[model samples]
Target: MLHILGLTANFSLTLQHKDQDILNVMSLVESTKRELQKLRDDGWDSLMAKVASFCKKHNVEMLIMEENFVDLRNPRKRTNISNMHHYKVNCFCTVLDFQIQEFKDRFTEVTTDLLICMAALSPIDSFHGFDKDKPVRLAKLYPDDFSYGELLSLEQQLDIYIDNIRRDERFKSVENLGDFSCLMVKTQKHLAHPLVYKFLKLVLILPVATASVERCFSAIKLVKTAARNRIGDQFLSDCMVCFIEKELFDSISNEKVIKKFQMMNERRVVL
Candidate 1:
């Protein structure tokens, strides 16, 4: 468990980063999956050494791993398994196998490819992350969004788009994708590269990074506690939105709120 937790700590840190883009997040996911699999394959001896060191430091008695493992509560049931097998196979390998399977299940090949293709839309380092082929492939992923003709047009547009954006002084100051997107609109580049802009918008909308979703889920715990379990979905959603965007709501005056509510329906009393 300790070794597994240590390995997963990197993933936790990556997920927690506020400025993480889809490109990096997707890369992290693939790297983490590889690390976990590598650990599962060749990490038994190292993990056991760490466990032994901890047990020694704490004065915990080491088990005779070669002896048969017996359940004290169920002595009648004769199970033939050594302590080594029980700990190494039943515990360590089992946990590692489960984690490996989870990574595989969550990040299937198709999903990973989709995310990688989306990463081509990242606008970091003066559009250094841009890939013309990948975005064209990304457009292929969603046939409904990009018809056959548009796909062809997207390839041509990407050629001009990259050239134009790279030369434009206004886009040099753009940092993240959000800023790049805003600058594109401000300079009317989005209109010039409509297909590329559409792909950019698609990348922006994908929930590739977990921070925002995790934040909302954490807020849900506070907003919908046991005491407030009966709150309807609509009301709960409203409460969550208010709680999540408190800064935005705080800027609105109470008088404006009252007037907004006053307009919702006819009331006998006026405030």
Candidate 2:
């Protein structure tokens, strides 16, 4: 899913039957797609690259990409999926095949700029996606105080929050709320394709970065219980860096650590 300029584009698959056991297929086809000029001088390197460029054109400044985002559990899907086009965001469902019409109907009238998803708790296994996680959950932590009661009623609390996001202002939209609610109810509208993984796998490279940090912070809140709420700022910062990404810390040579340790160790380990 992607959001830009009060528009939300969603993709999904499901199964359905038509006429005497015959089948009707529908999917997201990127027909009549538009390109936003001058966002970047570089053209796309591949289909996945195009998706990233397309996302950028949609005016999404930041993209969170995951490695191996797609999960192609079915082997035959290698040739089942096809190219898709869009001038704007949308949602659609298909069973046993791709359906473009369905995608159009879901996203045509309404425009949504922001996507709120509950942060994923586990490592991303593939391009598998769940729209239910609220993306705006992290934003709530930014000293943007809302009463506990108000937070529970966020969707009802939404005051057409699209414009606020366009202006880069604080807009009260909960993360993954739509994914969990509107999108979830519509899940069975489409059919899963074998090539679903390829599409998503290709897409992962396009996003600017992965939404890993959002999940990390959410985890932090869970671990740093009320008893640890008052922990020192520096300690927490260091812990997050090491816990979430020790590789970055590892990039520093042991020699550097040793030198620092010689001065500060004093029987205590330090970075």
Candidate 3:
């Protein structure tokens, strides 16, 4: 179990990479799914051998695979299953299957499609990730933002946009979506390709820095408690911002806060 779990743990760490582009992240996810499936099909024998070696080295008793299984929780209880069934099917196979299903469940067809579409907008590799169809599909996902006529316009713009961006020297060195968006605005490309820029804005809204968003939501739960259910919107917003950005807020001196507060109102007793 540890051996199987250790493999998935490494995959988990790989997914946590801060600098990985969305395209690479999706590829890693797909590769992990295949790897886990392959491991399930052919890893049992190798896993068993490793377990046996560890048992022998530690002077641990080893059970025969063919022997009738005994339940450790209830020794008096009789079971018809073999030790191999209990260890392999009940433990190893179960764990692997659950992880495989989890990967499948997490990256469903819609989510995968969305990521692929989003990847098309990635500026890494000199706009090599650009796909005309995927970005159209991405725009289609947001029907409210893109009308039927706008979709057709977007396709035409995409043709010109890719050609323009690839040849343009300004965007040649741009890497990642954040830098791409900033550079696009810097060069006023957003004005030239309004629809594509809108799509880029939508993509930028997605939580690329996932840890910060998660921390913000967790901070909200703590700040907006039952006692503070009636907290005003502006006050809640300020409190939540301070709570989430503790380090930044911590650097703010109390004297500075008092001075700022004093400036906000004409206090008769001025400090």
**Top TM-score: which candidate number?**
3
> Would you list the C-alpha lDDT of every candidate in the order shown?
0.84, 0.34, 0.85
Q: Rank the candidates by lDDT, best first.
A: 3, 1, 2
How many backbone clashes can be found in candidate 2?
A: 52
Going through the candidates in the order shown, the clash numbers are 0, 52, 0
> Across residues 1-271, which tens digit of lDDT does each residue of candidate 1 receive?
7668888898878878767666677778878878888887898889778879989999999888899998889978876999889888998789989998888898888888888887776666777878889888878988999999999999999999998988888877777778888888988988888888898888788765468678988899999999998999999999999998988999999999999999999999986
Give per-model TM-scores. 0.79, 0.24, 0.80
* Poorest 10 consecutive residues by lDDT, candidate 2: 16-25
Write model 3 residue lDDT over 21-46, tens digit each, in one string: 66677787788888888889999998
lDDT for model 2? 0.34
Expressed as tens digits, the lDDT of each residue in 82-150 for candidate 2 is 323111211111210123344445334211111112222111222123231232352244234444554
